[model samples]
Target: MSNNKMSRPADALVEVADEHLDKVLHSMAGETAVAHDDQRTAVHALVAKRARVLVVQATGWGKSAVYWATTSAIRSLGGGPTLVVSPLLSLMRDQVKAAELAGLRSATINSANVGDWDTVMQNMESGDIDVLLVSPERLANPKFAQRIVPIIEHAGLIVIDEAHCISDWGFDFRPDYQRLSHILTASGATPVLATTATANKRVTADVAKQLGDSTLVLRGSLARSSLRLSVVPGLGPLERYAWVDEALGRIDGSGIIYVPTVADTERLSGFLASRGHRVVAYSGRLEAGERERVEDELRANQVKAVIATSALGMGYDKPDLSFCIHVGSPDSPVAYYQQVGRAGRAIERADAILLPAETDEDLWKFFATASIPDVDNIDTVLQTLKESGEPMSVPALEGITGIRRGRLESLLKIVAVEGAVERRDDGWRSTGTPYVYDEQKWAAIRTARAAEAELMRAYASGRGCLMEYLQRALDDSEPGPCGRCSVCTQELPLGGFDVSTESVNAAQVYLRGADVIIEPRKLWPKGVEDGRSGKIVGAGPGRALTYADSPGWRDVARVMSGPDLPLDAEIFDGVVSVLSRWRRQWQRPVAVVPMPSRRHRLMITDLATRIAKIGKLAIIDALEVTGPAPTDDAASLVKVQALVAGLHLKPGVTLPTDGPVLLVDDTYRSGWTMTIAAAILREAGVPAVLPLVVHQLP
Candidate 1:
């Protein structure tokens, strides 16, 4: 197990046994030749001696080939199976297919394939599996961890794909990836291979330290010569969407349009389709089958583009993908580079353009905060679990503690690593281990994030080579201008594409027509079982122009903020447009009622009066704000209580006993206010309440 025994000369190329190596190479490349001798030699040496290695190569540099070849070489020598901890299901699917082509048996155990886990395990036990791909989250499953103990004990090699996720400095860091270090420690002398295309000096050094001092680090240049990089900054949301729609027709080959949010994915996809483009929306919200189908469509060039969020990222193999356009900038240069790398992999040249919006910084800040664990919240969760003295499911914990479900799960994973909690079949329980909140670690992460954001701003605005700037930001050894970027070639434009006034107007019209559906709460949140908090009755469908629609609705929502701000013409037109489109959904209401607002009474009154005037319905004063305003940050039950006590029927108003009424509000968030308002109206003898709002927060 000595480093010396496992070491090979840096300059020496080890000749691997040709019998199995040649077969693997032919199967992977579809030819009887190997591309990179250095990569092949390094992987072969690592497999032969069972040594730890780190491969820092650019995307499309055939990193997968190295691991597949290593698996084949080791298995040929009568070694145990290779375990690959992939980060995404798409990556696993691609890897499994590639392994099969290389004549290596591969199977995956992930959330999507629970029904096939038994079969996979059977194959592994019977020595029919050469590589077993599992997600990092799978490592946290107690049953899977227990079942994989023997396999890991004798694993021939452990490949950590997307290894940057293991480091805190990495842009896509996940708490579940930390579990791999523990597994590595338990694997004894098993050789490990970690790979990433997006890591700077800090992230690489951090990962190397975690892997051990004996780990051989192989670093390569980060520049993608085939990618032609450019940026079109300062585009408003509507203009950006318009530009993307226009550019898709000009860009060669099918590609991807990356947005930062799920809402944008749908909005942009719909807008593009309205403009006569064939595209699909791909996000985390899509079902597994849908995602697979979209991936297939993209591979077969059946669509012009797939408007997607980051859910389509990391190991989605489309060899001829010719372009990648970002509607908004990612938070960091590393992530941006990794995403842009998806294009031009097997081609001579491709386009990588960014349309940075004014609101991208705000979106980045919100997501960055969401990822960091809050110190006080973590303490509160740990104390609650300790007091319970027994395992509690996430639902029960959400009831006892007021934290959101997603944040709570993230905190639990962090504490589990610190030995302060453990996940059991029943739920999660406190482990009584003393845990110190690492203020310094989080502070450093925050500082690094700020620096990365600043770097992104430079990338968007600075006069320099975009590819070289990214390379330098990633600390590439030989960072220099690629002579292919918009700046380097003196072809930088204020806009990425020629968007006509007609296209812009069409985009605006589409945005104005966009409406979000507000589904009634069928069941109340747990722990709120009182009469007022149970299943809502007589709740009809609601409609809104958009939910936190960036750039498009920013001005419209601003007008709804203060008491004196008048409702502008654009917002009024937007409301009119939404109502016209939603006419079929609810038809015309018999009456209109304004939900009283303490802050935006004027705006709400104006909106309700306009709607009533347009629909030729009688306007009625139905509800009043009777209590002090509820804290916006309060928990759900607290907000519900405030709304329940605050809203009441007007003292002298007569209710319509058996007709539908349009309930109006300036904005909708959490749906508590609307729920309580509808319940009040229904209790006051209205047959149905249909909620309508100008804006809804997503």
Candidate 2:
């Protein structure tokens, strides 16, 4: 049956071998016409020419076609061989199937076929396989490298799918990707073609860096015009199910709902099924048959929706999906966009909704706990791997009890000691075990952990358009309000704080009181700013400012509502009330004075406690730290200094010096430590010192 049929060529989105181009098109005749845009064809032609390229396509933009078609064309041209490095098994399977359907020979090499390695290798050596699909781990095989040398010499194309995985901005990262450029260079520097559906410019650059030079970039637009975005607030896990019910009840056509955890998927799926809605659960733990059945149902339109995690639509090509909902916030915007992108694949109007849960705070907390693994953590994990002497998968490490994916990944490098773990064709393995924690490396990890935590917290707490937050997080450049977040919507009232007109300058100066000259407006206030006080404005453009700075920093006043605690307080009724009542507010935590001022310090502590019980605010301590607090009113600022100090120094250690400080004396005729401490703190570059004298000083 050696028949070679030429079919009609599709437009730009796909360009097959002149011999098989028509066949590829004919094969896809009823499967929705492949997009025929110029960018698609040009990118394809470039790949066929063996030119290194970076193609950025939007959601549902058909980036896969570019790779598949070009590879088929190369096979026809007798380009020795080609390899497609994909991030997921699903994509590899689909690609293999598509190539076979188009009548081209393609074979996938992954752990699933580890038992039949000889068979796959024979096929590769004999040239029976035109295209080899592999995971990054495959690069570790010495034999694979030997096999690819000839192919590289013949000028083969290496396609890195899900290219964003190489970038820090990507939700999923593979350490093997960091070694990709070197791997290719080892094979004689073959041309590279990287593809991703979602990535900002910063991420795009990282992708290229992993591929080496001689790169051609093909970027698409960010606008998903065919999709509509929306959000629902004030919903927890179970309550959110109700909102999902209401939303799905109104819409028709296939859709997907993404949950943060597997437990959530089960609960939501069960709830929907119980309510007589056709739903299925998709998670990594699902059996192969069950996954196939669900996909079949989706293709048959037998199911209305599927409540799943990121595993649902890896290689799914259903075109008529109408909605995509996120039950919880994704840690990063790149991830959110990719997850929701599974919807509206058919060029129809689709909706994407994000339902934020109270517990959604978990994502940020998790991020704070394990944002970026420092060299030390990475070494620790790698050292453990070295001791195991067995290759492992990322998912396997992620499944560890008590350890989060973020922490596990962050620790990999520290353990690996910079590429100590070689990327195996099947999995990752550490080169050797370590005897102890490298103190230098551990210190580096600590420093990085703190910096990353602050960054994540800022992302979560910054008052602005949600879109602005997303954009800024993805790109470090200054971004304006996105005008599309819940905070940006006019219907939602000011959240998370109280509003006031006090200038940050005045409040800061007043709090510092003659210690610092620069009087910035106070950002936290108990009520809205008035004409007589400061004005309210957004800190950055395109961002909302729940509490903006106004004039006469002194004119605006913020009433305290709660006690000054050292940690973030839990959300409660009173906290919510104060947050809702005042658009903005500030909290001044009265610091302790070491001198004899017991009664006054107690009163100040009481005042602080009362304010904390009433509103949303930040601490503005008015005292200098000389020694331990005389009363609770003056607690230790030792930890605070440790936190604010430069990372070059050891943690928990404080430097002694004479700096400007505010002294809090009980109805004092004279201020001592508060003043001296203020001087010391000021000399240490502290902006201002605010003195809270329990009784009026006369």
Candidate 3:
């Protein structure tokens, strides 16, 4: 019995939607799930008006309810299954269960469920599935696109979750989402509804423009009355870790603690765990099962918190997630809003705390240009493909074009969707599609990014009411001092941003004790050193005194990188600490060989001398580079060739043939130096090479 509520009178359809909405709410949220007025209105607009809508509302506003309810009504009216282009795997999982609660059969197609694709497609084709969800990546997949050509043709509704991603102006703009918009542009009157809680006025307008001018834009205030916002600025990395440790003692429920990078996630979560707080480190690095386990742990309140990077960004649903603490500031207010929105959704009051580190701007700067394609990069990629006259994989392109793997793939995807490049069964090839570089458009985006970074600075400074500031930044009509914010009341959660000295000191010990296991390069770079290729073996993981500009030893890091100085007692002790911990995992080394370095020769000599004295091992400073180290580090492939040619065991040097030997370096950058050094050591009859460095440049 299809509700086919579309044929009912306006008042009757609204009432029918209320019934369907409650069932959906009841299934996911339990009974007492009354439909919000806006939820029913949006459903009515989809069913009765057949309108294409964009809903930019705050989190926990039941935006999902509007779509689920409309799907139910449309299906009851003998319409085809609802087609949802979601952005993340977790969201698809959540929505599939949500569809079931609304009494509909649902299935999803994503990378994780490849085995079930045929079953899902069969179910979809047979009209047995009421809702079908696929990620934007799948929408761009050639196979899935071919399969869905007929599916969307009969789809009763098309929903774009996190629709802001369709616009280049979005905080998390993606090329695949833009493809979804193009699909809808041709899907003729299929009642498209795009939803996001993170779009600003420009993004909203851009999304609307993409959906067509007649699309209804329903944007509510960006304010979250349940969120109590505050920023604690000027914290160093150690202090940020300490602050979170201290704050957990006072906070009531399970929540998330966000870090800037995966390293920080490990650092903070380990520190928190040492303090007896139940937390887990989460990032894209985690396997699907592990990530699911962590998510379930948080959902069940089995753990106090999950320390994560932006990899845990969207679509993880936890209504009672009472807090969101950011260890570092986001680059933009929109990003900040999207992350902190995870909190206070179901609870009466949720704390949103920001511990803004001084180093945040550096990371922000790197990411600001990360996804924005550069003319030179695009040209290089295209030219290399043209020169090859054949399709080449991303790795081959990286080796040839000198672009890094991640950035190269991102560029390829953008250009592929734009028709400048095409992906084949084997790899990617140049399509010669003219890239119309809209200089003005790109410049405006860059300027907007800079402006948004400044807005985040303002947000972190408490320039105005926190809620009102975010609302205004997003162009929401909502304005005013949220009387409960730290700026308005001069009150702060977790006792006014003061971290315990006990925790800070513990953080120091923990940071010093943490192991920096540098994974040995798995395979030699192709297109370098006469195209060395094959699995790298007999090279075990290396240890480091510090990784990057470690918070616990930033001062020492600066001196080591800036000045050619001998190791200080403090830094030496930390190195010993790292060695003490790392030794537990590897066989003891019998000798120490300092990596050849011209720039920091004195420091390297001193470090080798100290290791020789302390560990009582032979100091074999036998290997040497032939010429001045490359003045500038080039791409991985180029640098490998330069380093391999120059870096070798000194002519006729005696070598150790048994067990692992310690290879020491003052620093590691691009890793080519250390990698080549280790390979040289192995070839010279050393069974294994264990590298140790003062700092590993990030």
lDDT of 3 by residue, 1-698 (tens): 12344567767766666666777778766787776667766887787767889999998888888888888877777788888988877677777777777788889988887899999999999999989998888877666788888988888889999998889999999987786678755776588899999999899999999898888888888899899998887777788778888888889999999888888888788888988999999998887678888988999999999999987867778989999999888888898899999998888999999888788788778767777888898888988988899999888988787777777888887877678887776899888777766769888998898988888888888888888878877888858888988889888777775777888899998888788878778877777756567766535788888777667787766767577778888888888888888878888888888877777888888888898889888888888888656544356786777787887788878778867888888877666788778877887789988988888776
In candidate 1, how many Å is residue 447 off? 0.8
Best-fitting candidate, measured by lDDT?
3
Tens-digit lDDT string for candidate 1 (441-548)? 889888888888888888988568899889987999998888888888767433345678888889877876667888876655666545454577746889887788
Quantify how close model 3 is to the true structure by its C-alpha RMSD in Å: 2.5
The runs of at least 3 residues in candidate 2 whose Cα sits more than 4 Å from the true structure, single-residue gaps closed, are 1-49, 111-118, 137-155, 185-189, 368-371, 377-410, 413-417, 423-698
Per-residue lDDT for 665 in model 3?
85
Q: Model-by-model lDDT, in order?
A: 0.82, 0.53, 0.82
1 or 2: which has the higher TM-score? Answer: 1
Ranking by lDDT: 3, 1, 2
Residue ranges of candidate 3 with Cα displaced over 4 Å: 1-34, 529-531, 627-633
lDDT for position 293 in model 1: 93
Any runs in candidate 1 off by more than 4 Å, and if so which? 1-22, 35-38, 493-497, 529-534, 550-554, 649-654
TM-scores, each model vs. reference: 0.94, 0.57, 0.94
Which candidate do you rate higher for TM-score, 1 or 3? Answer: 3
